[model samples]
Target: MHPSRRAVLAGTGLLPLALPLLGQAVTPVRAEPAALLRRAIPSSGETLPAIGIGTSRRYEVAPTPEAIAPLREAVLRFVALGGSVIDTAPSYGTAEDVLGLILAEPGLREKLFLCSKVGTPGREAGLAEIERSFKRMNTAMIDLVAVHNLIDTAMNLATLRDLKAGKRIRYVGVTVWRDSQFADLEAVMRRETLDFVQVNYALDDRVAAQRILPLAAERGIAVMVNVPFGRDRLLKAVQGRDLPPWTAEFDCASWPQFFLKYVLAHPAVTCPIPGMAKVAYVEDNLGAARGRMPDAALRARMETYVDAL
Candidate 1:
């Protein structure tokens, strides 16, 4: 049996709050249908859900029903709860294949703002990888395609632009997995007409905020934040700790929301894609988009609180 939301979080220093937004039986949380927050993609003015799912290590699983049932439920229920963005990549092993199968369910793909990546060097190789991604993800046109980790970025970005011009992809951008590579990412952001840039930013991992985020805002580019929990490092650090009483002011009910809300509260963040394959965890993460986001002062307090942990 899939664990209840509370069961999934039993020992992680947090009690799962009832999620009015999630109605799946796989997740025990219950409440009314509170809408997930929506923010505009600056380049196009199209809106997307403030919270999204990331298919990385969590989704590189066999496509058998026994292996896929939970991940499928998570994706389907995420859309039911109003999530629109789903980011995957060619490097994520069987993730795109599994996602293609799950999203094949009637009306699923249309409801999603599907994003994928390509990392090959030459234009022809990049095009081949993108075509493979399209086949793996079962889509004719991808909403966005980024150059993964800035691999052959100039060539890839040019390729992405050509694809965009031909209407093969809706948007073109780049991604930076590590904070140390911010200089290259920054240079590209300034030089290219990108629609998005995926970067890592949790309360503990604030390097992106120092410049990338603000620059994206300045340049009318959208920001998709990855590794919002410091790639699980923050979760490990907060284990067995108590939720501070003050978190209620902004309606944060769990650790995931607390971490996600911190990222969401930043004006420049278009979405925070936390890697979650469990329905219960998806329910918990979606709640971050429903409540009062912390103001700058509250955000400062949150940083200090988490920093001292």
Candidate 2:
């Protein structure tokens, strides 16, 4: 359920303590339990927490206990603080492995709306990779599985369909992070029966917004935004600039929140899976899901503001 105005109180005690983020303890955003925004999967109507964790560069750690300790803590805190979506892939080095170990932490796996991808081509290879993903993530079933970059889209998607039909997976999706693949992504969206589509959309990168997002909504496919910050290009673009005072009209607090809120405000977006490497960052990003979202007018202003920078 999406958080309501009655739920966005100053202190609902959502975050009780400061958490370690990159070894620096910082005040986590105080959120309301009822206000933590969630969006439904158009396929199964399963709602997901709006902010998701992305294990790309962050979770590719040395699988030793010491090196994996911080990541484990972050994942636990993320779930503790009302987060559920966790996206990982086999191509992301030891990310799947790290999550496998982290999943062993009692009661964590079931709490997550876990998502992984199958990047390899061919039927057998795709099936094998999906099987290995389950082994690597230490789960018998995953909530959602996507075709990484829409790779060999036909065969891989066919495999995902079989897995879903067998109840081995709950939902099937395809991902496209590059603008060049927009044609391919949209074609699949129009042709296939999909529960979700993971794509790159952000304050700076609005190209996907032009058509892809609308298509997802029209097709009834849930949308998960990847690289909402445009891979940090948006962050670096706004560095040292004070957030426009008018931003507070919608309850936007920080630049990161601004970036994320801009994406989430779109009627079509389900969640923006930003890569939060630390516990503090995760808390900060969740703030976007708590406050009043910017309206369409504010969204236009945001684009103008960023383009001027």
Candidate 3:
């Protein structure tokens, strides 16, 4: 069974009353037209869909077999809808295992740009985590393995580089989710050779755009965006607001699309992974990937509209 909504909210530091009850079943609703946008990996030029899924609080808290059933279907729906990237980590409870079970099915493995992270503080621990991730993900080779939160960057990157050299992984990267780490993250971007970097950035949180984003572009490092909805905080911000008619000029059909489109508009963003347990939310999130993204003038209008709210 799924954890009580109260329990899940507590784990995520959100109040229980903010979300619907857990036992109340939610149905998966597919988007009318599956939308997809592609962005290239800086090093290999491999194109990944601009929208991806993240397994953090959503999958981490729902570790039981029955609780994960819908998640499997969601993953299948994600691929069916044209999404290619799946971002998870050893830290995210049984997320890797859940993904492994789904991907083990025929044709699903190749459909994913499988991505996971290593966050242990030492080289040995990091390597052990990598092995565990591979085992749990049921993949002999992962599309990307990132150093989570920049922990032991020097050591983990060295090991990941070795793994990449040995043909065990396709790309190696590093990530930072907190603002405090931007300095260290920028330093790593300047000094280290990496294929990608994942960071917390959203329309409401533009701090990363100041330096981290430009640095990534300048250094030819692909960027994966986390918390594009600001962990549901941004969702609450736009709750009852209708999509302004002008939002359609850039192809935004819903609030999630508006928020995601804002982030993907930046030339440097490779993908944005939004976490969702329900397939409906996944479909809604994927809609942002379709058609045209905001150009400079439209982006300015988007900023003004969001700021006025």
Candidate 4:
């Protein structure tokens, strides 16, 4: 049984609230459809759900029956809740193999917009890695392949471009998680005709908002936000705090939604992929996609509230 349905579940991940928007009382959101929120890929205008799931530390596990059961359940729940994108990397040990198992089952691949990365730094190594990715993912065509952290970026992007041209891959781009690497990331973004750019951005790490996000908007590149919870640091910071009552204005019902909605509220953010290890947590994370998003005013208020904390 999924823990979420075991009881009427609610969360307050140390969230803070200020005065209600225009003093409006919290209105209930009971009958909203299960539709997930979506944003457009600037390059092709194709829409993707604004929330995605990541498989990093959470997914690097041995291929035992006990280990895969919950991971499998979380994935199915993610899709059932209107999620489409699933991000992974070769560096995430055994994640690709595990994901291949899930994807090879019936209709799962068609339902997901999959993205993987080649973190190796040489031409042959990068090529070898992506080929392995193809076989491991059990897909002849990958949706997106990025040069992780821009290692040997030019070479990897070149390879991905060739693959894209051959229709072996649909999009090519790069990813970076550290602020120290943003300059190099921007340099590559400025020089390449990329389809996507993955970067870190959370309530705690808003550096991407200043340049990377705006540049993506200007370059017509889709943005995938990583580390939305500051790799769990933000969650730890807000531990035991109460959610603001006015969060309902933007349809935020829990702390996870508060963090995710903050990232999704940005126009340039296509999706924020938060990793989950449990079916119930996946359901909880997906809840962020169902409600109203914070507008500019509320976003400012949210930033201020988190900053104060």
lDDT of 4 by residue, 90-116 (tens): 999999998998786688999999999
Output the better candidate (1/2) by TM-score: 1
Error of 3 at 148 (Å): 0.8
Query: Tens digit of lDDT per residue, candidate 1, span 1-309?
Result: 223334533535333465455574333444455688899999889999999999999999998899999999999889988998999999999999999999789989899999999999999999899999999988898999999999999999888988999998999889988999999999999988889999988999998988999999999999999999998988888777767878888977778788999999999999999998988888889988987999999999999998898
TM-score of 3: 0.87
Q: How close is candidate 4 to the true structure, as a TM-score?
A: 0.89
Off by over 4 Å in 2: 1-34
Model 4 residue 273 lDDT score: 92
lDDT of 4 at 254: 69
Which candidate model has the greater lDDT, 2 or 3?
2
Record all residue pairs in model 4 with backbone atoms less than 3 Å apart, i.e. clashing: 14-241
lDDT scores for all predictions?
0.89, 0.87, 0.85, 0.86
Best by TM-score: 1
Say which prediction, candidate 1 or candidate 3, comes out ahead on lDDT. 1
TM-score of each: 0.90, 0.89, 0.87, 0.89
Residue pairs whose backbone atoms clash in candidate 1: 20-31
* Candidate 2 lDDT over residue span 1-309, tens digit each: 223223333446557365576887766565545457889888778898899999999899999899899888888878988999999999999999999999999888789989999999999998999999999888999989999998899999899998998988999999988899999888899999999999999988899889999999999999999999999999999787777889888787678889999999998999999987777777678878986899999999999999988
